[model samples]
Target chain A: MQIARHIAEQPTTIVESYRSAARTLETYAPGPIGRVLLIGSGSSFNAGTVALPSMRAAFAGEVSVVGPQDFLRRPDTVPVRGTLAVVVSQSGASATSLEVARRAAAMGCATLVLTANAESAAAALGLPLVLMPAGDETIGPKTKGYVASVAALQAIAARFGADIADPAELAPNLEAALAAAETRAKALAPALDKVDTILVAGDGADFGTALEGSLKIAEIAGIPTAAYTIEEALHGRLHGLSERSLVLAIAADEVGRTEASTVREALAPHGIAVETVAAGPTDALPTPWCTLASTFLFQYMAVELALRRGREPDLMRYPGLTRRLAIKVDDSQ
Target chain B: MQIARHIAEQPTTIVESYRSAARTLETYAPGPIGRVLLIGSGSSFNAGTVALPSMRAAFAGEVSVVGPQDFLRRPDTVPVRGTLAVVVSQSGASATSLEVARRAAAMGCATLVLTANAESAAAALGLPLVLMPAGDETIGPKTKGYVASVAALQAIAARFGADIADPAELAPNLEAALAAAETRAKALAPALDKVDTILVAGDGADFGTALEGSLKIAEIAGIPTAAYTIEEALHGRLHGLSERSLVLAIAADEVGRTEASTVREALAPHGIAVETVAAGPTDALPTPWCTLASTFLFQYMAVELALRRGREPDLMRYPGLTRRLAIKVDDSQ
Candidate 1:
């Protein structure tokens, strides 16, 4: 109920605040960083998938994204010199992210913390912080927090040298995208209603977006779902691709469009019903009604999918489980 | 047949040479210099998993391990300063491992290239090249390459700071372990005969060992299989645990004894047939056998399993498929 009220009151403003914060980052630290590492846990980690392509395009150097769990367990894999560590967290108190931040600082790398809470431990670690304005959620499972993180990261990418042709045009496009998403969500609600398993796919920038979309459905719908890069899905996992599987493909940009099309083609032969929301053809201004718009639509679709299955779209029962088993950090050793 | 010959002729001198090289590392570098990063691919990476616990115990600072695929994908996650990058490869031609070495050199990290070929690309990069004397394999899949990589890394650990109790004592222990592994494999062959799917479980050092064991089975036996850390196995994946699932639990030293015990206990409750290969008692002498002996046993068991299922263990129709597809690096991009 608390999450529902928060969602009802500030959905548009939360999206707007993300746009504003992204503009702030562009104004502050613009241009190529030597290396970029995105680290987070669970949904926060999954959120990084959405930003992968954009981050690679924005940062001229190598971009590597991993779960904080991987980084914590394998710190030596982290570059010690001239590297930028971007720690992503919704609560911002994820034990592993904090430890990674501490380790990165000790190794003398430039660190940036992104979270909904600017005052969280990650921010307190003296790193430059990007705070999402979507406020906070007391919900046991993340819904708003997840979307807010994606929007804030999108803003960060836009601010920090994303190859967008027109920066000033982003706001209106984003607004339109959200509206388009709502309409699409309503239309797709029926198909999502009866599905027990889902498969989401994308490539490049949308790969992470597809992953987040899959996680959103899993966390909210309690349905077994998996996400894969388009190429990886085709390798061996394609055997699981079938008519009964609800395949959601996000084709957000030119890099992913061809692969997304290939995936759709491959699945069609198997009689799998494919739902594709892609960046519209290039002649028009890259409208939010296309790629960026599809993200919100998928989030809405996941909610509808949950409702279609007769599950509450917002309620989560697994509260305190995450905090209790907060990623075990071996600080003592 | 080719793989069998490669194993039979694999020089014991290679083991001796690795021991000498490890001693050289101890004499020069002694104790942990900074952070140590172990990098490898396929079987070589599997060797790192076996070496991790002892390496961590011996080194003063952090010791983390990852495969070349993971390292190349996320170099920013690796420590860039005051770090030593250990690149392990048997052939040293492995594209990913070579790239990792190049990246480490670019980052100004001290690099140690361990390989069978002294003139390998990884070695030619002018890092401290420690050569193993293991001969070439005609078979596409690894056999002796797997064991040699482990022996080489184990020697390095002993040299750097691994508490092996007595260095001179390892050779005899390794021989005994190999013989014991052969015996165990034959005894367990009956259970593995009919299994179509295999699951391997271990904790700590053996976690990586189990992964390699499973990979060998998958690559050689051509069966669907997966390996997970014992803790990860308990996290919902246990639902898939079954009698049809051939479970190989590698119970190595005290480092993993508790979790290994838990995995063994958990499986029986689910009616999953479990086989436990005791590497040693909880307080056994620290040796590769303590981690690897069980893995070696399972590799042969898996082959027998494949034989019973009417599949030829050595003839891989999928040879180079994983290398060509599963791990295609976008080097051009």
Candidate 2:
């Protein structure tokens, strides 16, 4: 599948972004930024969300992730002044995202946009634009785009003084992680195909990965899947689970592992399977690039499961329905 | 089911909270509140989230909802000093809520906690406490407590200069709304019982209603349910649908109606049932009390659907599993 190729392309994307993002940030604002508002939707949103913690640790300003509709809907709640509002749209064609950029700009905020298309409406807004080095992903569910988006945000955080690992040093690790994820996911896809529902759970950085991973599975495999922060699932969402349910836990940290094990033990009695997937190494990248590993795992699993179930992994199961909504514009990458 | 009784107790709970919440807020901070940071998890978080737009309109400063884990996990993202941090817990026993209250207080934010139990660890923090008039919800999934929590936040917004409708006036209206909701839910219960999955979608004020409603269904009905802001669902989650799927759209506002209709029309081609629930009257209450109407509908549907499916509504289908997570402390409710 082309997605497999896209998954393999993530390592180079990260390396190139580390060099380009800093130069772009410098041009946007030479002065130190205060509060950071990273905005996007779907997979784009997940990438920015996954990098939030490291971004916060890198700089003192409040780093927050906002959905395009949420930000546009709530004006009074936004901190505009001295706020660096970065709108990330991998395709640069989310209709609401362009509105967010326009609104953020009009509100006198330092609005910056990162996308693959410079000629797209969002980049045409004349805001500080950073075109991702990640090549085109012509599919509905993104694989390389997710990695590039996260790496872009991490580069921005690193520039802001976060003690991030150099992206150059992670090439071998990313390749190794991707290979391991493919093997693990291929073996697990058959079991996943038999489940009626899937719940992907994680914590901290992995929470963002879980969200993106779940979205990939839902869109690509056409499986009924949901994402949850481990704590949130524990709070209430666990009640609906049954023997037909399968849970994929992205446990990269110690706390995440504990929570994953907790869910595993709790659901085991019900004959539900909770698989803890490969958490790619977090030590050698700008942020916890382990999410990149998760990116590979979920993507591979989705493709394998879709193939086994006789579904198309590259295209959305119901494209006509999604297109009718007009969420993404014609200029979408 | 005690749940039906608890659901019936909502109107009285709303009326009582209007008096108590205001008096409590005035005592805690006689001065105007600038920025608001509402923190909680699950239903508590949903309650605060539902009130955000109204609270923002009530004052100039930012009003935002922060799930306890999200707030605590990202320390740098929080806006502390001079902010009013409202930590909500119907049971006052969310393990992370106590930590959120303590942290907010320590950070010099005007921390206020709302809970039903005066003896809760969260309430006993010696910080300003506003006990909910919600009474004892003693069950795993709350019905009346969700209504009471939303009412309390709305009262606080009213005190902050929001042009809210009097809770006294909502008494008869709420009663009428509740009766209407029960009838609607009863008829739909049989249809709902057959679905393997449910997606509760809404926008604006109804968005919060959608979330709490989904949780209620997932927890009480033992049916796997997910909630999505209509916009978010259109983004990607719409892909994971089948003939067995049911979409419950809370169309409170015009935007909500359009979105709901869109989802309905699109999904109908796939044989998925999309039911647009009643949007309670928006004119009579501060913000939109129509969500309260949705609250009743979702609660009653959850109960009736549970019974039809032979799953107990008042008790969790798997209590031992949820309790094992320790998300809620021993003193919960």
Candidate 3:
């Protein structure tokens, strides 16, 4: 129920997040940036993926996104001249992220710390801090926080003159996505309990959505899920699928639809079922906007699947998972 | 039987590849390079991954590896001034790889085409060509081609002034890895039949080995497999693990051992087993060398497991998989 509320609140959250994102971008780098290195984990990382295409389009010099752990151990070539390291940690309490900010600054790179926790240590470190609008999303698996981060990243790219549409323009699409997604998710969640494996496939920016979708099913629905680009799904990875497998093919673009259809044919012999998520015919959003809105499809399915399995959607199967792993810095610290 | 013989021939293949790799580097650059971008698909991608760390160390400016599909649609920042696009397609017949070479060259970037097929369209384009010693690997899933590509990339980095050990130095280690891996693989082959899923974990350069390991199992053993860095394996993904899950942790360095131990302990509650591949005490090979040689572990297991599963180790479940997808240029072309 709490997650359902968060999902409903995403449209409003995106508006507020956009304002903060614009201000953050100006403060982080007054001039247009030629290079940017983004670092985040889990849902935060997924948000970065949504923005990468536009960000790459804007900054013709260079732009890349890596998870926090990988960024910590990345080559010295990073934080190179004129590079801005954008740290997107909703909690702003990841140990690796804190270390990355310190190292990036020490290496003379411009840095910005984006999070909902303004008092967090990473935010208090004199780094440029931008607070996300989805404040205190107590749920273990995020919905509002996910949309808020997506809004912020897209806004920053748009601010830098990328061909990204305003996040506010997509708010209505978000609301419509949730309503349509709920009916479909409720119907599909029960059958997923019998599946041994779930494969999510997409292309380009849609690949990012597929990954987030896979992560949600595994984290909340307690299913074994894997994400691959549409092309890669046709690669050798298909040999392992069987009658017990389920595939979610994202028809976000022509490329996605064509490849997903090919993949569907390839899996015909194995009795694997593919469910395609195509954009609504009447949707106001276009291209990536409609595609990105489809994240709601996975979010709704995760919640419905969790409750169907007699599990709580808001509470994680392993409470204090991040704390126990020492990935995020302890709030008490 | 075909894949097994190829696995046994890696040490010999690597030696010849190193010779060709050295000559290729001279023909491609002939000087220390500042930036390089490597691209491949599947196994070729994995080989580029193994060589990435040292190559990054060699090129102080920038060094990155990407899949050919991603590279084809990559940001204009790629193939930047002073960048070298290293195309690692063993067959050198992938349409995507050829397209990338043309784009990179047209953008004023130096290019190298590493392949086993001298007559392949990519090599016939008259770009800097380096012949791999894999000869004609008729088998569906490659073993010698993987090691040969690795040798070529590493040799290129070393030629560009990176502190990489000679591939010849690892020949003894490869022989030992194959000998030791065979016994362990044979034992593992039968027990894997009951498993529903497998997760391979590693860190740093070992992460490259994890990807290749995951691929070999999925491609040859007909098992669903996924690979992740040790830290990433712990990030929420652990929640999806069940008793039927098998984990292979690669302890290729101190960082790997420490994180792999942490990962092993994390999966204890789920009753999941974590099998580690650690370097032998007397291994003449050092950190990444010993670690790179660990690819033999997966290669051996894939062959043995295929046989145990009543499948042919030499042929893929779908022999004309790539051809049907139209990813590779037609051999008739």
Candidate 4:
């Protein structure tokens, strides 16, 4: 499948995607936006999380990420006026994303759509667009689309005011990670397959990587995965940990790496296996790019686990379940 | 243990807790506060989430909930001035909570502490305190503390501007839910016990209840639980659904109920057993109270699952894990 190839092309694609949309982002959400509301479902929302820190650093305003349902349920939670809703979706036709975009526009806030499909239903809404540079994606689980979304947002943040690290700086690390993934993923798959539950923990911006990675693992590898902000793993989830559980900790910086190690040591006595992936020393590359590499590694791990289990990575086990709930249509109403 | 009895007394305790803090809340976070930030960890964070809608309705500005680690790591993500940090902790000694309170104060935002202990380290930070009426809970899983935290925030929101449904009005419903929980939880235990993974889904304000309940189940019942917003449950989680998976759908209103039922119907084809807990009609009591009843039911369900598995509900399994992460001491440093 081209999924693995697409994942490997992330370092180059991110820079191209940013360069392609630099001018649009300058005006897409221009003017002192009091708050930036990133709304999406699944991988799209997780992608926003990966770019959240840079957005916060760029703008002297609050940046928040929530699933589309949250905004729909409580529009009052968001600033109706000075807020810009950055609606991200691989397929902009998703009913939830469209509804959120409409609602955001109706509230007099500007809407910006980032997706692989510019001709999608969301485009018909006449919102500003930042089309993914990777173009069309046919895979069931998104690989290129997710990274593109993050990279595009990083471009927007840079235009806004953030001094983001250059994507070109991440090329060597990305190539190294991708080159090493197949062997590492194959080796890790056996241990992961033996586990009943997987907990992926990360701190700071990289926490988004954990969430994105866990979702892919759950979707493709058929593993029951729970990804939390590293602290949350301790707050309540530790009770469910046992010898059968595997903890994959993704750390972007030194403090996060220390905390992840402490968590591993704490769970060691309970016979839980811990796998740590330290992405960077904080200054290696952009925080978002560090997370991209970690996420890419986990994506490969998911494929390897699925391959080991004799299951098709692209064809998820319960194929119909996700499709039925992806978008709701009410003919009766 | 008196945990069950304490959980049952939540109705009366909530009203008393609110009344006791009514004057303090009115003055503590007074005036046209531009935005409100609620910070906590685990159940404390969930409690803030339950109160988010009412707070949004009451305030003219944005209302947000973040774990303490989020605020501490990225204070730039939160507004410095014209914001109030409502910090909730069952025990006022949680190091993370204390650090967040200090950081928010340093940023010139007023700090309000809502906790059971008024003399603990968090209260010693000299912030305004709304002491929990439940008082002196020692259970590891924190059932009463969770409900009490939500009630305290609801009271604060009422004082802010929201015409929240009265806690007194919810007493009857709360009592009814508690009464029904024993039989219902015992019945539901067997089905849940057979599952390899449990997925809990809820929409709107009630989503917080789902999160808190899932945490408790993970803590006490030793289940790998993933609590997600209704849309998130449909996004990528469905790929892991099987005959061994159990879905607990919590609905706070008609729309939520319908959406949850759609989730159930979609997952049914995948052999996932779905349990829907329709909290109330939208206009029943108040959104917060309906969630309270639903949360109470799940608390009992956790207890029942624990008892059925010959585990201690009050003394959670792997007790040392939480304690180790609860405080970070720098002896080596």
Candidate 5:
């Protein structure tokens, strides 16, 4: 809650920090490197999801988000050949991420490392490093760290050429959105307390954000949750839907707003309560949406839900599970 | 074993029949479309893993493999403006796939249905139907169905400009491959009786085949098995490497042969025995490599593995579970 209050107050600071970081790219990254590769693990990966569309729009080329494991496995499949490889890691020393950066470097790629630790292995790859001040981590699961990564990515997007429509004008709006999130988080406390399963749905670019939000709930609340694209939810998965199931619909912009509304309407008729985190009213005719704002809201909601249920909002019991584990690939041998 | 023998003996007949059915694609699919959406559920989707590269290379445009659920909830994202929807289903009446076909038709896109049942909803859609004569199963967990689906896709590829480097010339080699697979299936009885898990790995075009092979083993033998690209295996998952983990590496063609060999050699150093099915001499190599005559060899390997385990090769305990699932979109309503 203290961290949430801090976020509510200094939201603009995070945004400003991100903008500054983005500007640095123009100076550090030289050449016609056709595309961008946003790499991260876990929460950092979630931030990359939000950054992708924005970066793609700004860069006017292909922008893909791949996990460190994916890069290590088949670097060739990645769309960006001889392009910028942006490596994001929370600890900076994430062994898998470090190896990926090394692999990229070995492949003659211009590696860019983004992390909280300036001297991490990922940074040691002799890449231009963008280091952020470490955020609060009451429990190791990552709340503030996630937000900080988002801030960094957002700043990078603004710097590159994002049509963000005036940062000075939008700063107060972002703060207000955070405030709105705080208010909504309190209202949703009861539902979060009882619900064991949550389904988050989004369309297009927001799909990845919904996935990250669902993952956050799973990691923080220790609950079973599945995130899907809005259309994917309409498929066989809806069979698992019941009044008991909490549905979180994330609608970022007009691009997917209609589909999200259709999903909300469909679920509501089935007596399923639908909660939305968007830029405008769920009932609005045409809503202006911000995916970043919506993602942050849901993330905050998940954290509050965990705290209200007496669960540690940041500590993850399932970290380093075999399926999620990352190992350094010593390519030298 | 009898089934394997039957398949081996009638390889040309089966291939020709499947290829003829695949020719129907030209009738339904006329010209270049904006996108090609391939829809399938579970193991059927694995076929897309193979179809993706080939389709993209031939079509030279957007080709995405989506679950039917994804199509239903967000029809707009289905690339309806200018798209060809290909739905792959074993039992033509799969509820989710049916919805996917219906939605694609509603979107005014050319719908191509590939299935074993010509009378199923997929066929009734009145689109281009590639019917596999594999027949319906009284005992069903998708043993023959999986083989039929893969064969159908391959046949379609071969028909639709799939760089088949001398079609008639490849026929004899394919027949021999099937026969070799039958011989290897008979020989594998000893290994099949002992091993609990079969880990399959491939790269590039063959990666999908490896994934489908692993799924077949899991479905039929009811064994815990996993599949990954040769590169993915070297990531963190190699920690599970042991002599007990029966490694089945499918090294096909020039692309993935070297990586597959590297994986085989790496496993050998760990004292883990590796069995490879390839087009070349796998003997001088570290693994016990069998020169397979056809891709069908892996299918027989799955069947033989199941038979040796004393499990009914085709048992679907989760009945209606398939219908309740959506490959592209959910149509439970």
Candidate 6:
């Protein structure tokens, strides 16, 4: 499948994306960026969540991530004074993202667009575009796009803090994790395919990885899945789980270890299946690198699960499922 | 049945909660708060979401809502200095919330607790507590507690900025909405009870209402339910929706009306059921009052659906589901 191939090629694309963003940052003068607002939809939004640590470290002021739809509509929610709004979209054709860029530009924000396609609709808006160049993939369910966007954002964050890790250095760890994930997914698919629901939970920093994983599985396999902070899951979402529930937890640090164990123990009585994907040692690499590895591992699981369901990993089975995304249809007409 | 009664009495509880908070605010000195951080798990976190608009209006800096576990573990994610952290738990027994309050107080941030039970573990923390007494609700699902927390937060935000809505004035409109919602729930339950999955979507301003609604339904009816921003739902979640799926949307304004309509049209071809619960005539009252109405309406829907399934509305069907929350047990032991 095209998306699987894209997933396999992300280690290289992510490195290239970082280098490209680094070069772009040399000349990009985003003056007095008091508050950093990252705006996107779908996977881009998920990427923003994972990139928060770097963003916070780079910026002195508050950092926030929000979907483009909200920023476009309720501009008041985000303060425009001394603010920089970074708009991210893989295709650059997402109607909501374009609207957000336009609105932010009009509001006198230091607006920037991060995209792979320079000729896409969003590029034509005349906003300063930082090209990440993730290459082209016809099939949806972004893999390389998500990685490239995060890598690019990390590069932008680096401009603010010299201590930010170089994205080029993350590829080796990601490749190793990918190889390990390939084996793990093949072995787990048969058991996972039989499950009625998927609950993916991640500790604080890795919550976005859980969200993106749940989304990939849902879109690729047509599975009923939900993601939450492990803390939120313990609150009430656990009632939805049972013997047919497959719980995938991401834990990269000590707190996550505790959370993952607690989840497993609590669900053990209900006979719910549990799996943990750890990002190895947290101190061994930059936080985002570990986060990317966890994210990549989940993407492989989604691909393998789609195959187990006798569905094409690249092509979505449900019609109109991806219809409402990236493109704006004039349904009102 | 007890939860339903607790829910019905919230209009009065909400008013009293706000008045109590207002009186407490006169003596509270949370000096020079630069940022507002509200942390909780489950319904408490959702209540923080419902209060975002007011929180934003009241603070000069940023306002963020996060689960307590995340805040406690990923201390770097949130800016601590000159921050006001409002810790919320209905029972105040949530171990995660207590840890968060303790950490915030140690960090020199002014910390406050909003809870229904003063004796429920968290009150002993010695951080000044603004009691929002929601009365006794032995049921697992929270109704009055949610209403009261929002009221208290609203009162706090009012103290910070004079422009926030007056909770005292919101009671009559809430009473009117409650009378209307009881009728809507009875008519909607038979159809909803037959659904295999429930997908609740709300526009930007009302997304928290959707979250609370989804939580109520999940705990009370034991339904497999998920909530998303209307735009996020359009992105990918629609794939899992079909004839047996029920979609509840909240649209209280022009933009939301458009979004709700687009969602209905997009899903109609797939035979997915869509229901829009709009808080009529926003000009008649403050926006948060209308939002509370929509939240109450969904709570009633959950109660009616629980009755339709022949499940006790007050008792959670799944044992040990809420056990892991609030109180942390030593899993290693």
- Encode model 6's per-residue lDDT on B48-97: one tens digit a residue: 98888788888887788978866866676566677999999878777888
Question: What are the per-model numbers of colliding residue pairs?
Answer: 16, 2, 0, 0, 20, 2
Per-residue lDDT of model 1, residues A88-200, tens digit only = 87777777688888887788777777777666776677777777766656555455666677666666666666764332445455555556666777887776554545667
lDDT of 2 by residue, A1-333 (tens): 677777778778887876678677775553567788889988888888789878888767667788888787776577776788889988888999989999988998888899976667877888888888777778767777777888889888877778778777878888777777788887887776568888888777787888888888888888888887777787778778888888888877677778788888988888988988646733443336766567788888888888998987777777666567777787332
lDDT of 1 at B41: 63
Q: What are the candidates' C-alpha RMSDs? A: 8.4, 2.3, 2.5, 3.2, 9.0, 3.2
- Model 6 residue pairs with clashes: B94-B326, B95-B326
Accuracy of chain B in candidate 5 (TM-score)? 0.79
DockQ of candidate 1? Answer: 0.08
Quote the lDDT for B100 in model 3: 84
Candidate 1 regions with alpha-carbon error over 4 angstroms: A1-41, A44-333, B1-17, B23-35, B52-83, B99-109, B118-127, B165-168, B175-204, B227-283, B287-289, B320-333
Candidate 3, residues A1-333: lDDT per residue as tens digits?
Answer: 688888878778877888788876675553546688878877777778777887777676678878777877764657457788888877777777788888888887878778877778887889777788797687788777777777787777787777766657767776777788888988887787778888887776777788788888778877777777766676567766667788899886677678777777767766788888874322677654676678888988888878888989887666665665677786421
| Model 2 chain B: lowest-lDDT 10 consecutive positions | B281-290
Of models 5 and 6, which has the larger TM-score? Answer: 6
RMSD of 5: 9.0
Which sections of candidate 6 miss by over 4 Å? A77-81, A162-172, A280-286, A320-333, B74-82, B162-172, B280-285, B324-333
- Model 4 error, position B285 (Å): 4.0
State candidate 6's TM-score: 0.92
Q: Which docking class does model 5 fall in?
A: incorrect
lDDT of 6 by residue, A1-333 (tens): 787789889889888998999998898887887899999887888889888878888887788889877776668766788899999987887788888898899989999999877778877889888888798866757788888998899888888883667756666776776777777877888887567778888865577788788888888887777888887777888776668788888877776777678878877887988788785423355667777767776778788888887888776546544554324432110
What TM-score, to 2 decimals, does candidate 5 have?
0.61
Interface RMSD of 2: 1.5
Model 5 per-residue lDDT at A8: 57
Error of 5 at B100 (Å): 11
